[model samples]
Target: MTFSADYLLDRIRLKRRLRIWQGIGILAICAALLALAARFDVFGHGDHIARLWVEGIIRDDVARDEMIAELKRDPKVKAVIVRINSPGGSVVGGEALYRNLRDLANEKPVVAVMGEVAASAGYMTALAADYIVAREGTITGSIGVLMQSANVKGLMEKIGVKPVIIKSAPLKAAPNPMEDLTPQSRKATEAVILDMFDMFQSMVMERRNLSKAEVSRLADGRIYTGRQAKNARLIDETGSEAAALAWLKREKKVPSTLEVIDAIYGEEDLWAGAQSAIAKSFFDKTLISKGLSLDGLISVWQPELK
Candidate 1:
């Protein structure tokens, strides 16, 4: 009957689950209506601050880019706030997002509010914003780019299997995992990494207005706490979305009463609504089925197993 809070209790009473599902059904209905309203701009038509939730993995999203680009011309969108919560992803993904945000910033005020962890590419996205805020415990920075490859040459050799690679040039398939990494191939791969790192380094230097030496000192692929980041001049201050709004009101003169709308939640927000419903269903099936016995009554204290 007792278990961790973040995770569901190891054993759930069937009686409680019935009520939970009933409530989930109501939420599902409300979410649907909300999506329809958002799609049609039912509750949002006047001047407002657009909120872009940058969650999960960062990647090149053409549809999202197009939506953001449209904001550049949106007169009603008085300002934009980017809420970031990610551990970073591809270099090009971060670069494209940065450019798009910078373009938007040219026309309207843009602020970034970091969540739990916004490092690497996530940090790059924030750099494009006019101002940045984060929780005191948030993890920011980790300003670097990297490429990784795994080698199975030893495994292949042990299995008596050889790889036949045909390429136009030596550097074409430089880091093939099935083959030995020659000095030439290693040097070529390192060159690519260094070149990409230079791009990341330049972005930090130019966006933050820091000297090359200052950027080099901080961009050693290290993460800094929100407080440390402020002291290091990596971010403006440490706070939350409320702080971001206050800055906009003071500096950009954006009205605090303006309704905040989601920048990316348009016709496709139905999917987001459905995802919430589906997640609850998935959780019920996974937890209940695994924890139950043939008699539909099973209780064995196994916190580690759960």
Candidate 2:
């Protein structure tokens, strides 16, 4: 059977189109299978582990709050590991997070793994965990409270800057650095700071089971190495997260089969964090990328002063 060239060309084109469609159909079938497997959790077990990374200043922000809330609500999650590398922040902010962590611990095994430095309020939150682990050289345990104010009175005088204030109360501008602090105001502020310090001491005592005297000695706003913390009975152990998980399994009988899930801040959260990083990057390259910088919000519990 002799065929025309046009007919043969059309037949070839039709075959090529059919092959393309067949390839697409195969791809679609594979995709459908994958979707069904994912939907049914075919490979998904009850081991829905989650992790939370608490880096830098432990701020009283929506991101941190939402993470805590999700951890509490996730039933599939057997335990939570809070990876802390903060120096700390506002006394109230640290306390709020500590309280939240404490509550979360009650429901599930919440373990804390200290990164390079978890001092002051950072350690305060760590105490709320069922177990606390630190690296060998980890600088932890700056158990204290602090209030900082810039005393610009000297600079103001040097620059011939005289400030006039109108306030309802005598102590309204008590912490004004542009002027000399009155003895009465200093005393009042000191009293308030002492009260906060006392509360911090109390929280430490409750968590570590240390007597008032023990806590007082350790809570003198000092940083301790992981070994020192262990010796002082401040930290439960001196190790990493893996060691902590092993301990939990052996000592606490958390079961080896219990899944180890790192509670990440989710991909959606990544968008916001990325946005924040981009915004911060405009001011300084190291601001968002590195840990130490003076251009941003400083954590109150941070021991190192630049």
Candidate 3:
């Protein structure tokens, strides 16, 4: 009898589901203890709630956006510090995120607390903040536009493969991946990139108060160290999450007693947690592989090559 990986995964999933209720029971016990301790004033400090952490990739999705919107509207939150650690993604993705951050800043003092890497579209999303706080060695910048495609014409010729297409205009599929790019097609692609780059430059200029020439100097698709970014006026300060929070309290005059709570994905919501755990379990058992494509555009942060 042969036992395949899929069969093993199915068995594991069944066992995991059987054990889930036990895990939930343990969680309930822990929560009860915490609640009892809090009721008894375990730390002797009064309850405080004002600030929270907004984490993860900012995309066109409604979940993250809705959470951000709710936090901005909450009266208890005096200020917001965005914990940004993304390498950036799509153009529309960056633009939508920037708009939300800008809107949040309008109501409260919003600061970007950058992590290890916040480049390209990441920096684009950070432009709307009142201040940008970065660690000493954070990687930032890479202000430019990029679009990539692979040409498989040579491979098709070698293997005798071809793609047939029907379109109204010749230019519609002129830059087909299975063929060489024509001059006209290359020009068209360059035009699109140039327009996006121009928009990025304009945003930086308007937000950072830099002249067009100054923005052009830094927009050469080069990333900079946190220290270098501060010197170049790209970032406001070099600091960690704690330092950013302290600055918000001192400089921004957020209430001293206000609590700094982390706004996690679940945020003590049981339904959300259950759904996430279930999805995670399913992926881990059935979909995870050694050579999965964890690269490409959507990654919030990626390491630079040596």
Candidate 4:
């Protein structure tokens, strides 16, 4: 009986030791998993500032809008910094980005940091920010709308080709390259440009709190340096991204120590992007082959330096 009792006590001790080791292993695994989660922001568990880089030609993208929506929904994102570096692109692209950024601004503080060139639609995007910051030499402020068309009537005549069109109205196929543009069509095109320009001008006036005369002076399709823009009240300040962040900390009450992480949602499908590029190239080539240029509504600063 004494031997059996001693054996039972030994068995109890071993079982307790085994349970302790198992608990330690479980805790170690939990700690590792937690570290991984923090690193990847899986649960959005910590405070951070999101940096959104908008470089190259801007295009209207549904995926981009979705990503911005995600940024709005993220609780860990205390503020947003939009870094723009482009000569601008389609007016619709810039307008869409501006709208999304404004929506994001409603949820969190947002600032824009201009890079080398932020003109036309780029400037429009900057206007969406709650605060604007640009480098001293940054080229900006080509505020206007544009449309271009070409007349290939001479080339068509030389090639012995005849153009045919059947339309319900005189202006239905008004600006085709194979034909001449009527006076009525020219006036119609100008009207469209003017209407868009009005929208852009109004956006600037309201965003910058400038009077009509002030906006009129700045919105004449001229580029302005960052310093000039600041003087003209086109931008709020002349500074870099660091200065922009400092402003957020000092004025907006965001913590200065929060980590800044890039807000790249994910890489767009490679084939989709490639296919779009190919399609654009094909379209441009086809137009040129027919003695014409790409004609569309755009707000871009395409400078030809010689």
- Give the number of the best model, judged by lDDT: 4
Compare candidates 1 and 2 on TM-score and give the better one.
1
Each model's C-alpha lDDT? Answer: 0.79, 0.73, 0.71, 0.83
Cα deviation at 52, candidate 3, in Å, is: 6.5
lDDT of 4 by residue, 1-306 (tens): 356878999999999999999997776566555444433578755888988877667778787788788889989899999989877778789899999999999999999999999998899999999999999899999999998778988998889988787789988866778778999999998998999899999999899999999999889899999999999999989988889889999999999999887665434443333323233234233533222232367888877659
Best by TM-score: 1
Q: State model 3's lDDT.
A: 0.71
Candidate 1: RMSD over Cα atoms?
A: 11.1
Per residue, candidate 1 scores C-alpha lDDT tens digits across 1-306 of 765864554345665888899998898878777666654577758998988878656777887798788788888889999999877767777888999999999999999999988988889899999999988898888887766567998998889998788889877766778777889998977787788788888888887889999999998888899999999999998998999999999999999999887764434456564453344235333534332221111111111343
In angstroms, how far off is 149's CA in candidate 1?
0.6
Q: Any idea how many clashes model 2 has?
A: 5
Error of 3 at 209 (Å): 1.3
lDDT: worst 10-residue window of model 4:
271-280
Spell out the clash pairs found in candidate 3: 86-300, 87-300
Assess every candidate by TM-score. Answer: 0.80, 0.75, 0.74, 0.77
How well is each residue in 7-70 modelled by candidate 3, as lDDT tens digits? 9999999999979988988776665555444333365533333233333344564555666687
As for candidate 1, its clashing pairs are none
What does the lDDT read for residue 58 in candidate 4?
A: 74
Model 2 lDDT tens row, 185-296 = 8998888888888888888888889999998888877788999998998888888888878876776666767766444342344333333323323433354555533322
Model 2 bad stretches (over 4 Å): 1-45, 266-306
